[model samples]
Target: MNREGINVDPQGRVAIVLVRARNPLNIGAAARAMSNFGFDDLRVVNDYDVPFAEARSAIDAAPVLAAARQFGSVADAIADCTLVFGTTALGDRRLQHPVELLRDAGPHAQAARMAGGTVAILFGSEKTGLSAEEMSHCHRLLTIPMHRGGVSMNLGQAVAVCLYELARDGAAPRTLPEEARPATAAELARYETLLREVLVTSEYDRRFPGNMGEDALRRLVRRLALQGDDVEVWLGMLRQVLWKLRQ
Candidate 1:
């Protein structure tokens, strides 16, 4: 239930995806938090079913966990989602995607959902946060500021914090028309694959190896911020270019 005056996701366009989460208790905690915030679309990406089954058995998380869907990978989990945000601790790893502070992410994330797009927030496992491969699917990353440099919040706590921030100051939904909506992750992934093929066919990757890595190319494709309608147009153009390059 949304607060009396706040309606962040009136149409149920936001989803929470937990990737590789191993702790059933933490999963229960995350589900409980989702229930508190009126979000029920929970997706779990795990190879095994034990953790999810165990979490769903918890009485407190029954509402959210009972309806949760499990997936094999992040790509499959977020395929229909138009906006994907990954959470991270900003460790010693280099990041290719843009980063936003959690407090400031709510407005931006809400905007995306309001624009007739499904939004997905990805929470990684309890032991380690989102891996580089998992994060490549995200357009941006959000991080909660910590008092201590290396101290990281627990997986469940992190989910609660991020969702709480997202649910605050919500207003009336401002949905866009179908054609004006942003491209979904599956659409973007298709576009990225086609674009990469074009580059490889034209030997651009060979010419500029430094910027043609998987992560870099994925970031570059996302940076374009293509809309729903623009994806096919770009794909067609790239297909033509690739054909010509092959000829």
Candidate 2:
């Protein structure tokens, strides 16, 4: 039996995002892995050669490459997705997003997909990994297990490993009851904007300059995993504060 036919539900809802990858070959290889795992949605953020689809490594996955979408930034790429996971090696940097082992992330992705939500798994550039700004857009960070002294895996291999785990775990039936749909990236973005304006009005940034407080507050909001209603409530509360401050 073809694996494609077996696990078809989440294929369209899950996207593989490559951020500022420099090598066309690596992009091709990532596309090939998506082909192997039955995930077709590919979103590339920033400055990738258009001919990457024709790389020799892409092999029979040319179609996946041909249909890939390009975006200006991680935020634009994942605007439609309700759940976003950024893949990180987690070397030494302190991160705000909750870190989950790659093995354990599959169920979370699966649950989001089962709940009729789109999921985006982000793979950063091979050289620098995800920048702090890019990772902030993700709801969580996923790290593949490796030995303490192990060298970092190549970009394509990282995508393959994460997708394989997700595909494997996605075969299991969802056990959790349905709940309110999570807020979209755009919704959270709007909420962030309003909250920032409120903070500025309240002189929160003046007291704590360089936008440190604003950045921390953004991460805190993302970590909350707010739903649509939750976002609306927060937006309303913040807007009210902003309005009263003007009074």
Q: What overall lDDT goes with each candidate model?
A: 0.85, 0.82
In candidate 2, position 221 carries an lDDT of 78
Taking all chains together, each candidate's TM-score versus the true structure is 0.64, 0.62
RMSD of every prediction: 23.3, 23.2
Worst 10 residues of 1 by lDDT: 169-178
In candidate 2 the C-alpha lDDT for residue 22 amounts to 82
Location of the lowest summed lDDT over 10 successive residues in candidate 2 = 1-10
Question: How large an RMSD does model 2 have?
Answer: 23.2
Compared with the true structure, what per-residue lDDT tens digits does model 1 show for residues 1-247? Answer: 3556544563378889999999999899898888877778899999988999999887655688899999999999999998999998887889999999988777667788768888899998788889989999999998899986566798888888887777655532343345577899999999989988888888888889998888998899889888988999999999999889888
Model 1 alpha-carbon drift over 4 Å, by segment = 1-11, 171-247
Query: Residue 209 of candidate 1: its Cα lDDT?
Result: 94
What is candidate 2's lDDT per residue for 104-151, written digit by digit as tens? 887788778768899999999889999999999999999999999999
